[model samples]
Structures are given as structure tokens and as C-alpha cells.
Target chain A: MPMTTTPAEPVTPAGPTVPGEPAAVAEPRRRRRAAAGWVLLPAVAVLLVFFFYPLATIVWSSFTEPTVGLANYTALFTDGVSVTVLLRTLRTALIVALVALVVAYPYAYAMTRVSRRTRAVLTVLVLLPFWTSVMARNFAWYLLEQRDGLIDRFFSLFGIDGVVLLGSVTGVTVAMVQVMLPFMVLPLYSNLSSIDLRLMDAATSLGASRPKAFARVYLPLSLPGVVSGFSLVFIVTLGFFVTPALLGTPQQSLVSQVIETRVGDLLDFPGAGAMGSVLLAVTLVVLFAVSRIAKPTAALNQAVDRA
Target chain B: MPSTRAGRPRSIGWGLRLWVTAVAVLLLAPTLVVIPMSFGAGQTFAFPPKEWSLRWYEEFFSSPQWMSSVVTSAQAALLTGVLATVIGVAAAIGLDRGRFPGRELLRSAMMAPMIVPGIVVAVAIYGTFLRWHLNGTLLGFVLAHTVLAVPFVITSVSTSLAGYDSTVEVAAASLGASGWTVLRRITLPLLMPGIASGFVFAFVTSLDEVVIALFLQTPEIRTLPVQMYDSITLEIDPTIAAASSLIVVVTTVALLLPQLVRRRRSES
Candidate 1:
């Protein structure tokens, strides 16, 4: 009777039904939804096995391996090189984030002011580096920053002779700013484009000069985008590996390089895991703080959709 | 949009325009520089090659090591694309329509891979893969890459899903069509463009990925990016210029492919 009932039942939401047969009528729809729920299973299962399991393993090892009770984590602070590297990495990330913001803010603002076609071209410029291979870009910087390379030669034109950028923290910082520019621009553009230009005119008409109006009205409105973009770049630069490894010297290595050496060369899994945990903790902390102000993920998704 | 002043144009001033142009040039310099550098005939990794030749390209194609790495990368990317898309699209649909209690949590979890730092991911996966015997294997690379690629696929597919009207699907189902029939005739066609783009994104994510691949690589199973990394760090190989150019061309075409597909679908 149950099987036959499903076959004869009207599937339409508007179809007439007996007064007391609501449960029977709703049964097939619920069954259909439950069937659709099965589709989520494979993805959840795969992530559970492949993604979460591995991450959990590292988190576990950080505390458990090489004897438990926080020995590994304590070493991260007591070890001279690790603490210094962590601090330097944070300093470099802050500098990169600030420089990228200064460079990207005007470009993103200009993107909002341009004609439609010109705006599209500007958008591509921001995305161009994003799609470029990381190794390739780092290699390009390696060539330009080498001793007596183009950068040095150009500096020499101003009588700043014998300047070498390669193997210096300055070189790594310069290359990273370039790599991080797109991340900063996309979010800022998305936020800036949505702002009404009429508001700026309104401020100017209210007895304010152009620069004063921009500083007072426009800057506050754009803070959400700025914070998210700045935080995103800062978080990414903190864990950077390739650019620093290629363009920077061992003495100037960032946190990522330290982690790499511990894990890859030293095979010190517990120590590497502890340092990685700290990096993850820092990233999550920044992400949470930024999420309180702006929706980085949504802004990122919107930017990608537009692209 | 007109200017308040008689002679003042209502557009960005020259200062901002010049600044934007400079920033754009800085953004594009690395990609633009690599193409010319790829043509250098000399041994040094210099720009504006004194001698122009295709020697690096010849070397890239002629060497078995370079060719094998390319083949391995392609194989891994292809598998990652397929795996990520199938599961990612399904999850997107489920999250979009299915009534679930933890839907928001699930969505965030799906995007977690994108936010997690690459070095942490590499170390974590490398540690577990050592125990799982997945280290230095193609399957290992594909699995690890799929985790990263899934987020891109999910984002692209979810974007397409946002514009999709589900009422049409309901209409089909109420007209005596089976669920499978409705999905096959309605949902797949509408979601094809998104799915295609998601596939492209997944492919590119895997191909461009380096940190995780760098750890997983063995002498026998190196991907192109890893090989490129070695060529630079171990020794300065001008042949990497050729490889970099090839990657740029390949990625440009791959990223552009979905846009082309969407255009054709719209025109038809």
C-alpha cells in the first residue's frame, strides 16, 4: 500500500490532498531531499580523510611527539633561531602589507573611476600576476635583483653605485610586495566599485574641499576593504616560502623557510609541527579579527566571480 | 558625471592615471620579462639576450627529465580536476538547496583549504603521507592537490548556482518527470558553464601548486614546478626560461578556455 501510494500521489505542491493525508503527501518530498543529502557525503568524506586527517596528525604531533606536555612548543620559544625568525617574519609581513596597501589603494580607486573597457583592462592587470607561475615570477625577480643586475644598474644611474639587492631582506620585501599586490587590489577594487561616487560629490557640496572630503568620508567607508586586504596579504606573507627562498639569503629567512628546514632537512617533525601550529594560530587569529570587520571570503568570491 | 568646473574633465586626474599605469606595469613586469628571457641563447639568466635562439626550448623538449615532469604534472592536474569537480559540484548543490542543520559550518569547512597556509598544509600532508605510504606517488599528489583545488571548484560552481532559478526544476519534476530526468534535462545544461570553469580552476590550482608538490616529490615523480624550483635553487638553468614560457602559454589558454566556452554557449 505504501509503495503504491507513492506512485499514484500527485507530486505538485499545489495538488489537492485529503485533509488527514498531509504526512503521506509530504513523505515523497522529504524522501527526495534526504536522497539529495547523500550528495554531500562524498565531499565530506573525502575532506575528512584527506584534509582534516592530515591536519589533525600534525596538530597531534606538535604536542604528543618527542614526549608530550608541550616540550615541542616550549622549544619554539627557547630556540634562539626560531623566535628570531618568527619575529622577523611578522615584521616583514607588516611591512609588505602596509606597502601593498599604499600601492594598491590608488590603483583600485582608479579602477572605479575608469570607463568600462578600461576598468576591465585594469582588472586583468591585477589578475595577471595571480595567474603567473610563482616560480617563474620569483626567478624573474632573481634575475633583476642579482648583483650588478638591472636594479643595481638603475640605482647606479643616480650615483648609488655598487648596490646589490639579491640575498638581502630588502630584495625579498620588494619581490613580496609585487606578489602581494594583486591580493590587495582585488578586494579593494570590489569594495571600491560598489561605493557610490555621488557620495564624494555630496561631501564636496557640503563645503568640503576635494582632499578633505576624500579623507573624511571616503576613507572611513573604505576601511572594511582595507582591513581585509591588508590582513589577507599580511597573513599570506607570513607563511611565504618560495620568494624568500629564491630571493633571500639564509640569514634573512622567514618563518616558512625555518619550518622547511626543520621538516625537510632536519626531519624534526615535532619542532616543525610546533612552529607550524604557531603559524596556523597566527593566521587564524588574524582571519578571525578581520572577519569581525569584513567578509574576506565573500569579497574574494565576488572578485573571482567578476574575473 | 559632468565636472563642476568649466574646463575640468570628470575623470581620474593624470596623477592617479600615471600611478595606476606604474602599478599595472609593476604587476605585469614578471610575466612580460620571462617571455623574452626564454629566447636567450647565452648561459646566464639575463634579460634582453645578446643572442636570440630557441636553444632552451630545444633543450626542454629534448631532455627526458623535463619531458617526464611535464607529463607527470599534466597527469596529476587532469586527475585532480576531475576528482575535485565531481565532488565539489555535488557539495555546492547540496549546500545551495538541501535543508541541513550545519549548512553554514559545512560551507566554511569546504573553504578552509583555501585559507590554510601552504607551508603548513605541505608539512602536514608530508608527515601523514610518509606513514600512509602515499609519499612520492602520483596518487598522493593528486589527492593532496584535490583538497586545495576543491575550494576553487566549489566557489565557481556556487557562483553559477546563485543565478540559477530552481522553480524551473520544480516545474519539470511536477510534470511527471523523475528526479534523475529533471536533473539531467534541466540542471546539468544550466550548470555546464560553471562546471567547465570549475574544472579549469581546479586544473590551474593543481598545476600552479608548488609547496605541497615540492615535499611530495621524489627523484622519479617530480612535477614541473618542482623541477623548475630545483633548476633555480640547485643550479641556474636557462632552460627553466623555456619551461616558464611554456607554463605561461599553457595557463593562459587553460584559464581562457572557460570564458570561450561561456561565450559560445551564450551565443547559441
Candidate 2:
């Protein structure tokens, strides 16, 4: 957190909490137990009402409204456009995650070698775009990548409009990359910052080139953060709506957009629910697989501080 | 970023430094372009304007619709900040201290709103709120944003809680202090940074949010991102630039101020 100078300690919140009054020492334990139970109910209610209920409703609606079974899913799997769009969503997410890593690794490497002051500034900068609405920032990329837009003008001087991006998959990828880059960068930076500098130094002193040192030592050590970042971008990208909506043609719709159209355009709640249930199932499977290997503290970049 | 440490080169191989710079820039190009494009001063969004003008700047301020929308967004963001911070902080504290059943599952469930697609929530809220007669009110937007935003508050506040030293409270307890005193004097101060982090995240989440806003906002109560969405689809004038510019300024300020404070806090 930008509020402190050192790595914070992990102390669970149990101190001096309503338990140590002059004559109330004995009374506080019972009250503390009561308080803990009280906390449990609200937390449980919030998660259930907001999360499990909606998701379960989606699953129930998908199978029930259209008739309970994986029939909707069966239709999805057997249909021409359905499987293609699903695969496209996953493939695009993978590409975005891969590109973001390729770009973030070096920036993170340079960042790890910086001073505290510079590190803070860079961290803030990395997070600033994230702080703004991704919709707006994605629009910024849209404007930049628009045909004959800002980026096009620069390339125009060299007779290169074809290279300019507007509605192509590359344009969508570029915008999505920008939106997801911070997701990739922050974790990598934090992980690198947390790395012991001695290892890198030792690797270099042993005659490994900088790249070699980074590849052999820094890279391996930072695997958790890398995996964390990739999963962060990957999962979010799977459910992405705006980037593809703004940048890609109708044919290029990802699963999220398909769900959006099914819900918003067609008013087929059951079909939409079916699509959502599928995505949720896939996400849980992937995340479970990821948790099996590396858990990003079960936090999972929650909403871009991220989040 | 010739990233050396402590007044000396970090022993990084020179051959790799350029490679790093090139990739970083290539990666960071989209971020860098916002500056120049933001300064573009023509009627069109052409990157390098034929002529420089502050007319869009003037237009953004003078347009009542744009001005009012900006105000609406700030209002929503402010409300989201307060509600999310309070509820999120409370949840974080409870989760950190208490170990009841299904706590892990609860945490995951609460965090799912953030991970789930905004459109999914938008659709669900649209249907739910329409039934509740909450279709186009500021209250609906707040409640929706708050739900989406709780995870940020939880994560950021929990980040702070994780760093908190339970021993301090223990010391306070041993010294004949009550829980209230220990929390007031010791815990809150230490957790200020994390709390601030939660607050900022909440603010930004509300501001940048469009999916939920789309389903919620009436012409009577459009937030900035919602307004931007309308402008993007409804009209193609330079006024949206003015809107974009205002958002850019406010967002940049929001992003920079905490770092400034945090930097000053640490340095002094």
C-alpha cells in the first residue's frame, strides 16, 4: 500500500477488540464470541444473496426454463457459432495474457532495479490507468488506434494506414492489452521487488549475462507473480465485454458479448443464462486448476486494485 | 529506465538494456499516446491536429449537459466510496479476526462480483431492479456499484489488515486498555493507508463503471461513464472530447494525489 515504508505484517484483527474493560474482562469473551457469530451471518448473507444466488439462478434458469439438463449446453457445444466463439474467447484471452507478460516482464525488471521513490511513482503510474474507468481508457486506445485517428496520422506520414488499427482483432487485442497491462505489471513488479537482489547479482557475477540472469534466476523466482498476473488477465479477459464490443465486428464476439446479446438483444434469459453458466463453469475449472498450482492469496485481482 | 541502484549501475548487461527499453515502450505506447491525443485541438480526433485550440476545453466547461454529467459521476463515485469503504472495511475486519465456518467461501463469493463480467451484473440488476421499481434512480446505481465495489474494499482493507500486528493490540490489552482504546489509538492509525486504498479503489470503480450504469441510469440520472457511453453512441461531436478530457483530468488527479501524499508521508 502507498501508505507505508515497509512490507506490512500479517496480523489478524483480534487485538483490544471489545474485550478488556475494567470490570468487563469476563463478559467480553462471551460478547466476543457473539460478535464473531454476528460477523459470520452478514458475511454469509452477502455472499449468498449477491453471488451464489445469482449464479445458481443462472444455472437453474438455463436448465429449467429451457428444460433441465445440459441441453442448452448441448446445443452450445453442437452449434456452429457457439463453440467457435467460446474457443475464440479463450484463445484471445491466452494471446492477451501472453502479450501482456512479454511486455510487462521487462518493465517489471527495470522497475525492480529502481529506487524507492521511483518505484512508488512507477507503481502509481502503472495503477493510474487502472484507477480510471477501463471503458474510458479502452476508448482512449480506440481513439488512438482508430483508422486515420491519432496513431494513424503518425503512420500516415510514412504511407502506412494498413498498419493502423481500428476494427481488427489486433486493435481489440491492443486495447485489451492496455486495459489488462496494469493487471500484469503490478504483480510482476511487486514480486520482483520482493525478490532478493543478491540472487540476480550472484548470477551476473558468475558470468551470466543480464538476460541469462533474468532468465535463470529472476524469472523462476517471480513465477508466482507471473502466474498470478496471467490468471488475473486471463480470467477477466474470458468474461470481457467492452473491448470486443467497441473494437471488434459482430462476428468476433467473445463469450461475454454473446451473453450480452442473448440477454439484451434477444431477450432470451434462459439461453443467456446458459451461456453465463458455461463461462462460470469454465472459469471455475481454470481457476481451480490454477489454485492447484499457485494461489494469488485467493484474492485474484478483485476489480482492478485488483484489484 | 537505465535502472541502476544506489548511485551505481545495477550490473545489468548493457546489451539487454535497450531490449528492455524497447519492450517497455512498446508495451507502454498506448498509455503514452493519451497525452498527445488529449492535447489534440481540432474538431476531429486526429492525433496531430491541424491547428491547436482550447475550444474543446472551453466546450467541456460551457456545455451544461457535460457539466451536469460530470457532477453526477462525482456524486455517484463519492457515495460509492463511502458505502463501499464502510461495508468493505467492516467485512475485512470481521474476516481477518473471525474464523467461523464457510469464511473462505464467503470471501470468494464476495470477491466474485469483481471477477464476473460487468454485463452479467448489469443484466441481472436490470431485471431485478425493474421488478423492484428501482430502474433509473441514483439509489439503484449506488447499490449496484456498491455490490461491484465491495470486493475492492475487502481486498484493499484486507491488504492493510494482513500487515497489521496483532501484538500491538495484545500489548494494549495487557496494559489494562479496552478494545475500543486499542482500536482507536493503535489499529485505525496503522490501517489508514489500507483504508485510503480501499476508498480510492471504490471511487475509481464507481467512476469507471459503465456496465451496471448502462442498465441503471435514466436520462434523469446519468453518471459520467454512462454519459460517455451515450455520447459515444448518440453523437459524434467534440463535446465528448470535453467529457473525456474532464474525466482524464479528474482521474489523473485521483491517481496522483495519494502517491503524492504517500511519498511525502514516507520521505518526511
Candidate 3:
């Protein structure tokens, strides 16, 4: 009788109870909701201790070491070697990014034109290198580009003998472009695939030549991918260590190499910290500048969505 | 859309197709060359490697030093995968379900590792870990690699979480299910794919990571990639080709396993 009474009573009462619950339940639920955010504490804590704190230490050491007041910062400008290396890094990254873009655009376009089966094959080709280890790929390049390696031997058949590739900027750039083409192609392919084919047909029917139609219709829509891909390639190349380190000589050392030498060889913590901070600053500035110009946030989201 | 007009511009299309094929070959050539080169009969890296031999593979498999580095790398990668996934999944769930101030800022902060250059991170970690006396320690390797690997996990888990419906959790709650039960029965099952992928990704990232390992490496401890780096830069040995091919095979298999699992699940 008690169980039956409880069940029967609640059936009628529950309908009215729901309407009356908000006043009592709202405050406590809101408080509970806020407390749930603390679940992020462990991750935030780990990163703070390991990531942000270390970075802060580097930034702090840059000023405080060997007497304070911007000496390291000033030395970045005054020291010819540091400045030259920084400039060279920027120059080389730009060259690599542009060259990769040139190679990737056509490949990505071809991917869009192909059938699904063919596209899958092309994608695997692009991804094979990406999935391979950087050390392995760079080593392959090292063997091929060495003085009497495959590339040079092949060049000899064309009467272009004794060409120097290894230990040169050309060798480093070639390897980098190969390594980075996937980064360029994937973004460009996603952007291109999303494009409507009719727009090209529409532009061509409106009396624009094929190239003209592509420039006016396709190129503008594809600009977002281009900007995102180029910046991604450039930023990654800026901090590249493996390819440049193996293929390049001291004369062509990038800023990352500079940082490594300062810390490892010279034991110049503050000097290396200064260089690291500068590189970080430049990367952030470039990232923000690109995001501002091209809505890279949207492009990045699209890329991630497709992935 | 214009298949009927395809023959109008045949020459240019032919040329473009050829160029794209060439680019694909260029991308594949470097990685493929290692397969043949790894079998070089000569001591040095040589083109067309005069004769085929498995001596380098024997060297890789037989050398205690090389085998130990492989073991060390695998141990670190396994630890990194577990640590990063636990931390990353919690952060992703918190971001998804919690409504609080600075939530966007926290999300970006979690992702910052991916954007920050690797060498910059390596230098920062090296400098800090040196002072903390963490350099070259196994704990140091796991912690530092976790910092790099966590972002990938967060990205993967967040993507999966974005598609999850919260109304089912609310329904389970109203039926008197405990919070943990709802998470275990409803949420975790849906998120299993993401978690698995995240684990694999973190593992591969640690295995592939060289810059940080290079800085943090002690003479007592070294990862396979660091060993390969030394072998290539400090000495040009054919044994490195064997190591590289092994890495390529292992990583490709690791990356493909998740997709295969998903395909099987969908089919069933």
C-alpha cells in the first residue's frame, strides 16, 4: 500500500513540481556548472610548469644575464653573424615557401580534376613522404644531392658535371620543397575541391579566355588557401633543423642552427634565449599578420574540418 | 561540369597531367630510394648500390647500441601516448561542457604548441630542464614530449566532441544515472575512436621527434632518431638506411591501424 501510494502520488505531483523547480535549482546548477571548468586544471597546470614557465625563463634570462637592460636584444642587431643568419633564414624560408606553392598548386589542381579512385592514389603519394620520418627523408636527400650522388651523376649526362648541390642553399631548398609539398597540397586541394566548377564555365562563356577565367574566377577563391599554405610552409621552414643541418654548411646555417650552436657549443644561454625570443616573436607576428589579411582562421578551420 | 568540352583543350590538359605526375614522383622518389639504398653492398651511401645485401639490416638488428636506442624510443613513445591522452581528453571535455570566462583563451593556449616552432620549444625545454636537472631523464623525456604531443590529442578529441550530442547525457541524468555512469556508458564509447587515434598520433609524434631529444639526450640515453641524426651528420653509415626503413614501416603501420579499425566497425 505504501509503495502504490508513493507512485500514484508522484505521478500527479511531478507535473506541477517541474514548473516550481527553477527558483530552487537554478543557482546551485549554475554554481556546479562553473566548478566543472576546473577539470582543465591538470592540463593547464602541466603546461604552465613545463611550457609557459620554461618560455618565461628564457625571456627573463635574455635580459638579466650578463647584466640587464636589453644588451641581448641590441646585440641581435649589432652582431653581424646573428643578423646575417636571421636574414638568411627568412630569405630561405620565403624562397622555399614560394617554390613549394608553385609545385603544389598544379598537383592539387590535378587532384581535383581526377576521378575519386585516381584522387585517392594521388593523395597516398602526397602522404607517403609526410608519414615518413623527417630524418629518413632528409637522409635520402643527403645521398642523392651529395657531390657524386644520383642527382649529380644524372646531371653529368646532360654535360652539367661537377655541380655543387650538397652544402648549398639549392640542396636545402630542394629537400625542403619536397618535404613541405604535402602541407601545401592538402590545403590547396581542400580549397580547390570546394570550388564550383560552373564558375569557371560561367567565366569562360562570358568571353574570358581559359587562363583569364582561371585568374578571375578560380584564383581569387583559391587565394585563402595560397596564403594559408604559403605561411604554413614559410613558418615551418623558418625553424627547420634536420634538412638544413644535414644538407647545409655553416655558411648557410639558419636561425635555428644559430640557436642550437649558441646553446650547445657556446653555452650562451642568454644569447640563445634572445634568438629564440626573436624567432618566436617573428613567427607570432607573421601568423597574426596573415590571419588579419586573409581570415586564416576560417581557412584553418576549413582545413581541419576536411582532415 | 564540362566533360563534353574536354577535347577542346587537350594539349594543355596533357601537359598539366604530366607535370602533376612528375611532382608526385618527386615527392615519392626520396622515400622510395631508401628501400634499395638500404641494401647497399658498399660501405658508403652510393647510387645504384652495386650489389644487394642485408648487411645493414643485420647490423641494425644485431648491434646492442642500435637495439637499445630503439627500445628507449618505444618506451618513451608509449609513456607519452598514455600521459598526453589522459590530459588532453580531460581538457577537451572541460572545454566542451564547461561554460566559463577565458574558455576561448584556454583552447588557444592548449593549441599553442602546434604553432610554436619546434626548435624554439627544444631550446626553451633544454634550458629550463637543465636548471631543473631534468635533462636526459626518462621523466623529462615523457613530460617534454607530452607538451608537444598533447596538442594533437586535443585537436583529435575536440573534433570528435564537437559532434557529440549532450541531450542524451541530460536524459541519463534525469533517469537518476550518476555523472560517472553517464560518461562511461554514453560519452566515452562515442569518443573511443578519437581517443585511439590521439594515442597513436602522440606515440608517432614522440617517435619522430628529434630536436628535443637531441638537446635532452645524454650519453647514457639516446632515442633512435637522435642516433640516426648522429649517424648521418657525424658519420655516413649504411646502417642508418636500415633504421630509416624500419621507422617508415613501423609508422605507416601505426597510422593505418586506426583507419582499418574504423572501416571494420562501420562495415559491421
Q: Interface RMSD for every prediction, one decimal?
A: 4.4, 5.7, 6.5
Give the candidate order by descending lDDT: 1, 3, 2
lDDT per residue for candidate 2 within A1-307, as digits (tens), equals 1112222222433234454444334333333333544444554565566545656666677888767777887888887898898888888999999999888887777776756665565566676666666656766776778777767778878887656677777788878887888788877766766788777667777777766876898788988878878887888788877788777767777887788788767877777777777777777777787775555434334323432
For candidate 2, the lDDT comes to: 0.70
Please identify model 3 stretches exceeding 4 Å from their true place.
A1-32, A293-307, B1-12, B253-268
Candidate 3: TM-score? Answer: 0.90
Report the C-alpha lDDT of model 2 over B50-78, residue by residue, as the tens digit: 66666776777887777787788888889
* lDDT (10s digit) by residue, model 3, range B205-252: 898899999999998888999999988877877899998888778766
lDDT of each: 0.83, 0.70, 0.80
Docking tier of model 1: it is medium
In candidate 1, which residue pairs clash? none
Compared with the true structure, the alpha-carbon lDDT of candidate 1 equals 0.83
The order of the candidates by DockQ, greatest first, is 1, 3, 2
DockQ of each: 0.49, 0.35, 0.46
- Judged by whole-model lDDT over C-alpha atoms, candidate 3 comes out at 0.80
Cα shift from native, residue B214, model 1 (Å): 0.5
Query: Which is better, 2 or 3, measured by TM-score?
Result: 3
For candidate 1 chain A, which ten residues in a row score worst on lDDT? A1-10
